[model samples]
Target: MIELTLIGIGTGNPDHLTLQAVAAMRAADLILIPHKGADKDDLAGLRRAICDRYLGASTRVALFDMPQRDPGDPDYHHRVNRWHDRIAAIWQDRIAAELPLLSGKVALLVWGDPSLYDSTLRIAGRLELPLTTRVIPGITAIQALCAAHAIPLNRIGAPVQITTGRQLRDHGWPEAADTIVVMLDGESSFQTLRPEGVQIWWGAYLGMAEELLDHGPLPDAAPRIVATRAAARAAHGWIMDIYLLRRDRDQQAGRA
Candidate 1:
């Protein structure tokens, strides 16, 4: 009976951790951090930094190599499922080795809230062991993004859609959503949209020391964001970014 606790650490910022998240981390018997190779070593380092700050001297910490997703696979869902399966197997092995008796608390520090576009919960569901899962929620990238820009996520009485960059590129803006938040986009998918009457707020490394932000009408800001993102990714070797797009209903109506 392994009590697995997935604690959201939030956007690589130590201060973003909630009191509940700190309590859960301090209570864990073992904490597993995933190493995503050299390019993203800073990500693993951030987790280590958090553990160092929050955990007691007796708490155990382990690092596991993250399984890379197959980029060649045409079906995104199949590729991700296979990757998740591999990760689950790794988690099982690590837990068993780290805790031979396997009857204590195990923790994984997730980036952003586990409930929002994150797959930690989904991967945990695939574990073959007897497990009871607990989630400690933390700040989300959306929250951090909105905070950095000092803007609300949605207009009064209006809804906002959250989707991936792939969806935006493949399907264009959702017909029902006037505002959309795009995540997991390596490509500048906003380039695919018709820029007229649309505004965009883009940020990379949000809540981190290297944070960058740019916003304006889509047509004007797109070029600057592309340049900035390219330079930052080149300098850092890895980057996590998100953007918000909102269509001005009045401008659209005026055009119509």
Candidate 2:
């Protein structure tokens, strides 16, 4: 039986590792780190650094090449599903080759909580081999973004919807929630909404050294956020960001 542990390491900050995450790292027999080419090597490097900080010498660390999506595929979901299957196959092959006996624990460090926007759990489900899975939750980008900005995720009793950039652009604002926290948005999705009554709090690289933050009325902040996001992505070759939006009226009553 292969015991697969998906540990959340939080954003890019080493301090984000929880005690449970550290314990999970130390317990694993082998940990897989995915390399996303030289430009995004910092991602793989961060995982390695986490392992180096917490794992003992007995634990093994291996690097795997992260699969890239085929740009030519017109069907986004189909292409992603196929890509996931390829990744699952890679995981199976690596486990078999590295642990031929197939009795030891294997782990992968994930960004943020696996239960959130991350797809690590979904890909792990594609493993054909008999597998036991365990997840160690860590801070999410939403939480980090809120904490960095010293704002609450939702106003007192109001609901907050967490969504992606596509949803925000394709479906305008959610009716039920006064506040929306967006993740996985490469293009400043807030630009799609009317800036009249919305306030946006944005943060990139939340817990990292190169963190960037901005907030104010949507109209005033949208331009700067887009420009800053572009510059940051260009300088680092990659970026992880999240933002929270709330209608100004929602906060008029002074709710936390």
Candidate 3:
């Protein structure tokens, strides 16, 4: 039986790795790192850095090219499903090649907690191999963002909604939530919202050396964030970012 361990490495910092994650990495018979093309090569490099720091000399490391999702596919869910299916197949191929017997402990370093916005768990489910899956939770970008900003995730007794940029762009603000955390947003979806009483805390490369942060009333920060995000992506060739939006009801009332 193949024991698949999905270890969360947390943002891009090796220091963010938990003791549990380190133990799992050391125990794995094979560790697979995905190459996200030349643009995002740093992603694989970071995973390698983690292994270099934590793993013994005997630990086997394998690298594979990550499949690109077809942006032309108009249906987002369908596109992602197809992409996940491709990734699962690649995992099976890599595992079989490395562990010819097909029975050993395997590990994939995940960004942030696997339970959060990441698709590692979903991709693992698509694997055809008979495997017992395990997760070693690590810090999430949301946690890092909050910690970096030194703020709480929610207001007292208020519910916080976690959503994607697509949801905010398509549905406007969620009616039930005063505080919203937006992830997987390539476009500055906060621009789609009415900025009057909303505050935003935005961070990119949260725990990395090139980390960038901006916050303030949405109206004031939106443009600056867009320009900053664009410049960062151009300089680095890739970017992963998240933002939190909180509507100030008192401020709205005062404005009215």
Candidate order by lDDT, highest to lowest? 3, 1, 2
Summarize candidate 2's per-residue lDDT along 151-195 as a digit string, tens digits: 888878878899999899999888777889998899898998878
Candidate 3's residue-wise lDDT over 23-112, tens digit each? 999999999999999999889999999999999987899999999999999998999999999999999999999998989999999999
Each prediction's Cα lDDT score? Answer: 0.94, 0.90, 0.94
Instruction: Order the candidates by TM-score, highest first.
Output: 1, 3, 2
Report clash pairs, candidate 3: none
lDDT of 1 at 111: 96
Clashes of 2: 0
Give per-residue lDDT, candidate 1, residue 78: 100
Q: Model 1 over residues 149-182: C-alpha lDDT tens digits?
A: 9999998888799999999999988866788999
lDDT of 3 at 126: 91
Off by over 4 Å in 1: 251-256
Query: Alpha carbon lDDT of residue 190, candidate 3?
Result: 95
